[model samples]
Target: MPKQIKLNPLSIYIHIPFCVSKCAYCDFISHRVGDFEINGGVEAYFNSLKTEISLYSGLLEKSKVRSIYIGGGTPSSVDGKFIHNLIMQLKSLANFSDEIEITLEVNPGTLTEEKLNHYIASGINRISMGLQTTNDQLLHKIGRIHSTNDFMTSYEAIKRAGIENLSLDLMFGLPGQTIKDIENAIHLVGILKPKHVSAYSLKIEEGTPLSESYQKGSITLPDEQLERDMYHLLINGLAEKGIMQYELSNFSSASFESKHNLVYWENEAYLGLGVSAHSKLNNERFSNTSRIYDYSKLLSEGKLPIVEKEFIDTSEDLFESIMLGLRLNKGVSINKLNQKYNIDFNVKYANALENLLKQGLVILTEDILKLTIKGMDLSNQVFLQFMED
Candidate 1:
C-alpha cells in the first residue's frame, strides 16, 4: 500500500478598507467611503480584490480553506452582493472544508434587511459587529457612527436573519470611560447573549485624533490602575454571563469561539487578500500594500501588491509560536513544539523558564505551558523573556 499525505488546512482574511467615517482612535488602514470616489470607488476595489484572490489559485489548490474572515473597514457598509460574489468565487477556486466557518464584520447603523438577506445567502455563518461602548456620549467622543439603539436594531436584524454565531467587539480605556460604563456594556452583552465577545483596551496611536486631543490635554483617558480595574471587571462580569475567557482579549460561550482568530494564535498557515491584509504561509509572512490605488493598480496589472515580506527562520518561528500560543488559555503543548521544531523545549529555554517560574508568571505541567492570570496581565514582559538574545 502507498503512503497517504494530508494537506494542511488554510484560513483566509479579506480586508475591506472603506468605512462611513474613521474613528477618533483608529489607526488601521481604512479610509472614508466618500474620500475614495475619485479613485474608482468600491466597485473598482472589489474588482481588484477579486484579481488578488485569483492570483493565489495555485496555492488554493494545495490547501483546504477551513475558515474565511471578511474584516474592516466595516465590510457591512458596502453592498453585500460583493461579499456574496467574493465567497462564491472562493468556493469555486478551492476545496472548502465541509464545516468551513465564514465570518463577516459589520457595524451598527450600516446593516439593512436586504444586506442581511444577501449575507445569509452567501453562507456567512458568523457575524462580528463592533459595539465599542453602549454610552452614547462616549460613542460620539470616539467618532462612532452608531448609538446603542442602532446596535440593538442591528443585533435583532442579524438574529432574525438566522446567523447564530455572533461576536461583538467592545472597547475600554477610552477618555472619560468608567467602570460603570463597562458594566453597562456587559449588562447589554448578558441580555443579548452573543456567542463571542472581544474586549480590547483603546491604544491611542500617534497621528490619531484621540492622540492629538490627549497631547493637548483636552481629553483625559482612564489611568493605568483604572484601566486595569476595568479589565478585571469585564472578565469577571463576562464569565458570570457564561462567556468564559479563551484568549487574552477574547471571551466566548462554550464551543463558540472565533475559529478564524484561532488560526492566527495557533501560528497556522493562512492567506490574506485585499489591501493592507497580511498572511502567513509555510515559513514566510507578507502583507499587501496599504495604499488603495497602488493595490488596485498592481492587481490590475496581474502582479501581487505585496509591500513587505519576511522569511521567518527556525528560531524566530519558535519564538512566535510560543508568544502567540501563550495568548490562549490552553497554552502551548511542549510535546507538539518539540516534535515540530525538533528541539527539547526544556533544554533550549532552561534559563528563561527558570526565571518565569520563579516569578510565577507561567506554569509548565505535564507538557503544557500556560500563563497564570497575572501572566496574562503582564504578557508583554513575559514574551520579552523568551526572545532570542
Candidate 2:
C-alpha cells in the first residue's frame, strides 16, 4: 500500500465572539451586552474550546502548531482574568510551540495600560487593533464607539507595555468620504508608525445597516474607479513609508508581516474554535454552529462541534491552491506543484490563464506565476473563473 501523506502542520484560531457594541457595517459574529452577561459566557466558551481541542490532540502531536490567533468581537473586551484563564487552558490542551506567533485581536476602546501589560505577561506578543479610520466624523457615521483619541490612548498603552509587533486596521470608501479624507487618514496612520497596516474599502454586506442605508438611498459611496484609486493611493502611500504589500489589503514592514494570517495565504491547514468558527483539517473543512445557544447545548451533551463539513475534493483543492497562491506577491513554486498535486498551476489553468496574460492580468517568469498591477485589480474575477467545477 502507498504510504499515507501526513497533512501540513496546523495553525489555531480561537474566536471570542463578544464585543462592546456592533458597528453598523460589521458582519463578524460578535455580540454586545452588559458586562455581567458577557462575563458569564467567557468561561463556558473557553471550556467548550478546550473540549474541541482535546479531540485534535493526536493531530496536535503530529503537527507543530504554527500560529494561534484569538479574534472576533474584541478579545480585549474580556477582563485580564479571562485572557489568563483561556491561555492557561490552551497550554494544557495541546503541545503548542514555544516560538509560535501568539496574536490577540483587540479593540482600542477595550485596552488599557494595565490590561495591555497583563496581556503581554500572559504570552501575547502580537497585537492587532481595529482603528477603522482616523476621521472622527466617519468613525461616528459607522457607529464605531472608539474615537481617534481613544485609539491613541490604547496605542500608547500598548507601546508603554513594550509590545512592538503591532498592526492597525483601516477602512476606505465609507459614506461621505473623499480622496482628501483618505489622505488625511493615511497621514494620521503615519503618525502612529504602525509596523503593519491593513486598509480595506468598506463593503456593504446585505444584512448590515450600512447596506440598508444604501438600499434606501440614504447614503451613496464612491464608484469602482474611485475605490480603485483609493486602493492605489493607499498602496503608494504605505510603500513610501517602507511598508510592503503582502496581500491585497495587508501591508507590513519587512519583518512585521502577520505570521498568523500568512498561514491562510500559504494554503496551510488550521483549526478554528468557538461559535461559527471554521476549521480545515485533513482536507476536510467544517464550521461550528453559529448560534451560541446551539453550540452550548451541543457541548453540554459532550458532542464535538460539527455543524457542517465538506471534504475538499481534489479538484477543489487544486483551485484553492491557485487562488491562495496567487494572493501572495511571491507566488508559488512550479516544481513543488508537481511534487504535491502532480499538476502545474500554469498547465491546469492554461486557457483562462492565457487570456489573462494576453490581457496583462498575470505574469509568469522563472517558474513562478504572479499577478500584475492590472491583475490585482481584477483578481477576484480571475480566481472565480478558475474555481472548482
Candidate 3:
C-alpha cells in the first residue's frame, strides 16, 4: 500500500520552459525549437528539472504533497513519458496525500491521443488548456497556433481518456475586439460546458510583440467601458451555465475549483522548483532565476538558483494576507485577522477600506470583509493599497 501522508500543502511546481512556438502576446521564459544550442537539450532540461526537485526533499521532509501544478510556456510541448518519469520520481521522494491535485497546462493543438493517455495514466487528473478565444480571426491576430476547432478535439480526447476535471482559459479585450465577439465566445463556452473557466483581459506588457504593435498604434483595443461590459457579460453568461466565479479570474462548478491556485491566494505555503518558480515558505518569499541557462548552470553546480528571499515583516505580513484573502468569494475573516496578525486588520487599512466601502466597492461586516459587485469591478484599485509596502 502507498504510505499515508499528511493532508497539508507540500505542493510542487515543475516548469517546462519549451514550446513549439511563442505566441505574439506571451513574454514567458519559454524557448522555441531553434533557440536551444545543445543537441540533447530536452534531456538536459529534464535532468535539470529533476536536480532542482531533489533539492527540496530535505526541506519538505515527509509533508503531504497536496497538489502539483506543471505549468509552462506549454507543458504539452515536452514528451509525456518524460513528465510521467518526473511524476514517478516525485511519488518515490514524497508521498502524495489522497486527493492530490496534479495539473498540466496544455495547448490544444500540440497534444496527441497516445500522449494524452500517458498523462492521465501517469496521474495527472486535472488539465488546464489554453483556449484564448473561439473567434479564428482573433486567434490569428494573436498568433496562437490553435483554432477553436483544435481546442474542441483536444477537449473531446480528454473526455475520452476518462479524465473528468478540465479547465478552459479565455481572454477578452483583444486589439480591435468587440463586445459581440466576447458574447459569441461565451456562447461557445456554454456549448463546451467545461468544468472550470479562467478569464483574463489582455494586457500589453513590455518585450511582447503585441505591446510593440500597441506602441506603434498599429492596433486599437476596446474602450474601458467596452472592456467592463465584456467582463460583466462574461460573468453573467457563465453563471447561466452554473459555473460560479470563485476568484477574480477563475470560475468553477461544484468541487472543481483549482486547489493549487488556492494555495497561492489563501497564502498557504508551497515549494516551487525549476526555473522562474516562486515559493512562500513560512512567511518568506523566494523566486528562482528566470534564465534557463543560468538555472541549469546553478543546479548543475549544486547551488540554489534562488534570486530573492524576504522575511515577512509585520505591516507587510498583514497587508499581504489581507490582499490575498480578499480575492476569494468567501472573503477575509476578521477574527482570523485579530488572531494571526495581533492587530485589528480593519483599522490598519480602515480608512482605505472605508473609502472603498463608500464607493460600493468593498463590503465589511462584523466577521468578514469581501469585495462587493462594484469592488470586484474595481479590484485593481482595491488591491493597489496593499502594494504600498
Please give, for residues 60-158, the per-residue lDDT of candidate 1 as tens digits: 877788999999888987888999999999988888899999999999999988899899998999999999999999999998989999999999999
Candidate 3 deviant stretches above 4 angstroms: 1-8, 386-389
- Runs in model 2 lying further than 4 Å from the true structure: 1-8, 35-39
Order by lDDT, highest first: 1, 3, 2
Q: Best candidate per lDDT, number?
A: 1
TM-score of each model, paired residue for residue: 0.97, 0.94, 0.95
Best-fitting candidate, scored by TM-score: 1
Q: Model 1 — TM-score against the truth? A: 0.97
Give me the overall lDDT of model 2: 0.82
After superposing candidate 1, which stretches have Cα over 4 Å from the reference? 1-6, 37-40
| For model 2, the run of ten residues with the poorest summed lDDT | 33-42
* Residue range 1-389, candidate 2, lDDT tens digits: 99965645678898888888889998998887454364677677767767776776666667766688999888888777677666666666555677778889898878766677678777888899988887898898888999989999988888888888889998988888888877877787777788999889889998988888899999889888998898998998888877889888899998788888888887778988888999887789999998887887887788877799998887888778778888888876777776788776667777887788898988877588888889899999878867765
lDDT, each prediction: 0.93, 0.82, 0.85
